[model samples]
Target: MSTEKCVVCKGGGTIELLGAQCPFCNGTGEYTKTGESYLKSHICQCIFLDRKTCPLCGKKCHHDTPNKPKILIGPV
Candidate 1:
């Protein structure tokens, strides 16, 4: 279950969540997690290619970000 091609609606899947709104960080999302400041300027995956907003919960989207493997000690 790993697909690719989305880079900001470039794949035509869908992308557009309040575009063109930067104005010196007026979006008020968040950043400065450390040096170089994180957030990458108000997310730029175009907007969220498609719409489900799940890119591993990283912020942007484009596929390749779904990895949920946690068993710890399972046996069922």
Candidate 2:
């Protein structure tokens, strides 16, 4: 286990205002990845501090398209 917080909610386990659980950590504020290959990976802590959505439209945004709002993650 890591002491680091979730990237989406900043350890709150849920998105602010929306009242929805973080899709990344699933509201646990912790991330762990496992695979069949003898290797495991974890998300960087810095990701938590990065902006998740566009400040203008309040929609999910990315650097790839500064003026467009796209679905970063699909339904899971």
Candidate 3:
């Protein structure tokens, strides 16, 4: 997947210039590992804005699984 530059951190992954993690990306200018993909270094929560994406697979679905915040990544 191609990651676009973060609108907030602009791909720098930090804001305020204090080394503080960007609230939107948690320091990952693109996306952060969240929900069931916590062990992963990256998550598609940001990539999947509709929130219907499968955590185990990158398939978009219509299931009603409540979004859990294992580590909330930003929305694309």
Candidate 4:
């Protein structure tokens, strides 16, 4: 986990950045894991525009899921 100044809101943590889920990998960012696959939370929007990702699996976000804060990783 790294903390660089946010490019959008400039670190306000309030700005919403534009992004797309990795379609080829369903936001898993990775092609495959050694054993278990990554997963996202049904209660938390796991995709952030450029910040945190799925800690366990490194997925950005699921494409089929709505791009809402409730599921993605952006601030809510």
lDDT scores of the candidates, listed in order: 0.32, 0.47, 0.49, 0.36
Best by TM-score: 2
Residue 24 lDDT, candidate 3, scale 0-100: 66
lDDT string for model 3 (9-73, tens) is: 56677755345777766677775443224423333442344455634334444333365423343
lDDT of 4 by residue, 21-76 (tens): 43333343333232112232332234544333533234454344455433334533
Candidates by TM-score, descending order = 2, 3, 4, 1
TM-score for all models, in order of appearance:
0.18, 0.40, 0.34, 0.20
Question: Model 2, 1-76: lDDT tens per residue?
Answer: 7897655566777767467886667788774342211111222222223456543223444334443333354333
Better model by TM-score: candidate 2 vs candidate 4 = 2
Clashing residue pairs in candidate 4, if any?
A: 45-70, 45-71, 45-72, 46-71, 46-72, 47-72, 47-73
When summed lDDT is taken over every stretch of 10 residues in candidate 1, the lowest stretch is: 67-76
Candidate 3, residue 26: CA error in Å? 1.5
Itemize residue pairs with steric clashes in candidate 2. Answer: 7-48
lDDT of 1 by residue, 1-76 (tens): 2243333332333333434433223333222133124222233232344433433224423333343321122222
Report the error of model 2 at residue 75, Å.
30
Candidate 2 deviant stretches above 4 angstroms:
32-76
* Residue pairs with backbone atoms closer than 3 Å in model 3 (clashes): none
Clashes of each: 0, 1, 0, 7
